[model samples]
Target chain A: MSRTRVLVVGAVLVIFFVAGGILIYVNGHQGGQNLTFNVTVTGATTMKPDTLPAHQNDTVTVNITSDTDGEVHLHEYDIAFDTRAGQMVSHTFKADKTCSCDIEWESTGHPLGTLVVSP
Target chain B: MTLAAQILLHGFGPRYDLPIATALYLYAAGGVVFISFVLVVLFAGDRVGPNATEYPRRAVSWLVPIARSPWPRIVGGTVGLIGFLTVVVAGFFGSTNAFYNPAEYVVWIYFWALMVILSGLLGNLWYLFSPWTAIYDALARVVRIEPVWKLPDVGVWPATAAYFSFACLELTTGMANRPAIVAIAAIVYTVITLAGMFLFGREEWLEHCEAFTILFGIVARFGPLETDRDEGGKISAVYVRPWGVGLLKPAPSGWDRVLFVILMLSTLAFDGISATPAWQDFTVALKGYWLPLGAFGLFAVRTFGLILLTVAFLLIFITFMEAVIYLGQRKVDLKATVSSFALTLVPIALVYNAAHNFSYVVVSSQYLIPLLNDPLQKGWHLWPAVASFTPNFALAQASTVWYADIVLIVLGHVIAVFLSHLRAGERFRTAQRALLSQYPMLLLMVLYTMTSLWILAQPITRES
Candidate 1:
């Protein structure tokens, strides 16, 4: 090939690769499902209970149900397990003495919420 | 990407918490030390005399003797090659392992030993011996096969641009991204090299910046410019010389110096403001909009500073060279000039040492560990080594901020010493001596080292 032709071909190939990477990233994110949860704390404590808490070595079953029409993953207390639409998933977390056992929910294109734990 | 975009994106990363008071103190100290050291060197005169010219003459003289005894070369080269390979492997592939491994003493010792051997015996000999520089130079030569494009005759600005751009990358990016940046930098360098070759041919690129040029010049001041001596049994002072000697002289006016100082101050100001909590919050608040503007402002200031510094250095360098040449031609005593410059390096070394070690002093403190451990989860936040040292007092917990403040306090002394040493000369040597006598900071260093060791020995606790 002529030098000009070779240069042109090389430029095109570079652009193609970069464009393809971007496309893949965008599509993957778009295709991922969104999940939402109405997190309410119910425990016997003399405090305004909007957040859940557990003592050291205490196991608490976190009941999660998704209202949205997509799969959502509950990344609670360092655990990443999924919950399907209209289905409730109960996750049990053992609270370590050093860390407060708080639940967090993560999904595509949505804000993340934290379930605060206090001893 | 746009420069603004790049800066804004980079600002999202962690920053070191250095306070205004601490910075001012350190800056003042550094200034004093640097000026004092320069003055001292200036007054000391050339104690070594012409016979003490050790670079090129000794370099050549010792070579034959060393050639006769090859064991030193073999052993040195072997150790160097091994260490280089190990560092490359560890830095690239085994960084996590190296980071986690508590036995960092081995690496430290290896590096210190290598640096000492190279600097002491070779004297900036790493220019020739460094495997990385060697590889870069070789690749640069290889890329000359296709020399189609040419850079404009901007002079020094291109190199200055490259330096500051690399500095930005160093400050912002993780080590992993540096290789890519280096590759891009290498390409730019190769282009410049080739352009120089095309424009000035071989002499411009090789003779001017050649490793042996300064060495030869230093040797020539003592006796000979080259091995070839004259009919009168005297070594010739002039052999080969660089072109355009007139363009590379002292500035015509004092305004140049004033401009340079202003530029430097502005750059430092930008650096200072960027490190402030207000700057961080402004960036975060502006997020998508004002952040880019801030970044652009920083880049502009940084570039301007670098350019001004380069200009100042060039002016000073040219004047010094002219003085040397004039003295050499007249056969006047030139020993004092060389000695003064050599001694000036001491304060510079101290300042650099203190600046580089500041991060270690800050990070290894007793305060940072607890705050880093307090965050739950093994996610992005759990990365203590990454998140812990951030200077954002608002974003970071109180404990981290408190620890950072303490570090700043210690760093202030280092800066003060640096600045004070700058003015140290015969007139002020007594004052400098008095200052030094008052505080034997070496004892503090020893205590700090012991404390660090104790801290490292303690098992990491998850809970504060």
Candidate 2:
């Protein structure tokens, strides 16, 4: 085989490996069932409980209704569900086993809550 | 604005143990030193010569023959390929989740390890094994394409620009998390690769980004690179004859040595700051002041201090290491030194691992409730509350205890650079020149660090 052919083959192989690995990682860590919940944001600009209860494989639906305009994000968690003034932002997350949910509202700087999952 | 503020301060700051922020700052400082070093080397190129001696002479004997063999090269390429595949697949199919999974820690460490190892052991080994590079090389051969229709006669700037662009991506954006971003990046890279192949041909692309090469040369300065020189019959009797090999020789000194010291020190300072707990409380205190001024003040003091300390410590350590290598009549192997230095990163990684897994271990397991309830905080809150206990020892040694690996990585480069630049005349080599050009970028990094610290200072309201 020509040197060029060898190089191309190597490149293709690398691309394939990288793509395959990413697929497996995402699939392996897929959270359990999809969930929908009604979330209401109340009290001093925070996310209230600071935590919630969900099963290891359960899906959560968070319906957030806030009186104020707050930006909600699960920083470092790759989860950011933003809400507007008096508007609601709903998000669904696959709950891992024994995980605590850190729901943060950036606008109010007060709404930091956690969701405790019961195994 | 408030949300942004909060996110910057309490959210990212206290979380991730503030190491990421510190790393970004260090990266910025390295940029500055790099630019300055390059300019200095260019102007003073005449003065620099290969006057330095290499260390661990026997190791070079072993490495040279092995380097000629294709096995180590192939193995290195395979490792890189695996890592690339994992990142691509995960980005595509991973379900959206709230927290960084503890399990994924293994993969993160793997990526970090592989990148460091390749860069440290073989200079620019990634280019040889890089899927991107391979693709570019292959395409060039088939199509006879070249990216640069007109090769600029001027030296280095074009490549430097390309590299800086990529570094910006690595610094500001989280490309790994966003599939769209990653895809776009991949596409852009492909275009650049093909363009380069079409214009400058495959060899140019291979030589373009040299981040790994520069990193290796810097880290293993005292090792094999020093030894693998064509001494050209100057001082051949003292250094070359002693090694019983043609490759081993002493380095000549000039501006390159000065610039090398500067770059090593800058990186070390950044690493030291990351390891230091002193900045944490200081960051908190600075935030109590007015936003803009507080931010600027914080940046000035913290970054300046970090740069100064890193440079001073690196200088001291490098001088000492060189003395030892010289006295022992040892020739340094870049690969071995880097591998040894890489050991330090393990500790830093472990610390981050613990910090990330803390919630899972403490809250979910119900093991640390008693410790959390200690009288230190004056009452028993919850495990999360108790975890905030900042003992002096923990803070003092946080980098060593939690992120020893990062410290080690930084120190490894310091020693490598010091040993490499110890020669009398050959200090202003190409690698040293390249690093000198990056000082401006480092200053920019310092500014960014200060901004981040300022963001951390914003007051958190009890409620929205």
Give the candidate number with the greatest DockQ.
2
Off by over 4 Å in 2: A1-119, B1-56, B59-66, B71-75, B78-114, B121-124, B137-150, B173-176, B209-464
Model 1 regions lying over 4 Å from their true place: A1-119, B1-158, B169-182, B194-276, B284-464
State the lDDT at B351 in candidate 2.
Answer: 28
Candidate 1 C-alpha lDDT tens digits along B1-464: 00111222111111122221233333333433443343333323221222222222223554444434545444554554554554444333331322221112122222322342223222333333433334434555676634343444433333333434443543333221232233344345545554554555443433333222222222122222123346884433323221111111121223322232222222223333343344455445545652365647544443444455446544553355344334233332233332333222222222222232233233322223333432222242454564554322232221233233333323332333222222222212244342332122222222222222222122211100
Root-mean-square deviation (CA) per prediction: 20.3, 18.6
* A1-119 per-residue lDDT for model 1 (tens digits): 13554354345434533543343334222211222233432121111233443333345566655544342233223465465555666666554322212232333312223232222
**How big is the positional error of residue B95 in model 2, measured in Å on the Cα after superposition?**
4.0
Q: Tens-digit lDDT track for model 2 on B1-464? A: 11222222211112223233243334423532443233234333232334333333333454555545556546665655554554444334432220121112212233322334433433434544565555544454586553556554433344444543443333222223333344355456656655655666555543443333333333333222323333573212111122111112323222333333333334323323332345455555665552466436544544445445545644543454344334333355533332232222222222222333233232222221333343122343545565554322223121222233222332332222222223212322444442342232223223323332322222222111
DockQ of each: 0.02, 0.04
Chain B TM (all candidates): 0.36, 0.44
What DockQ would candidate 2 receive versus the native complex?
Answer: 0.04
TM-score for chain A of every candidate model? 0.42, 0.55
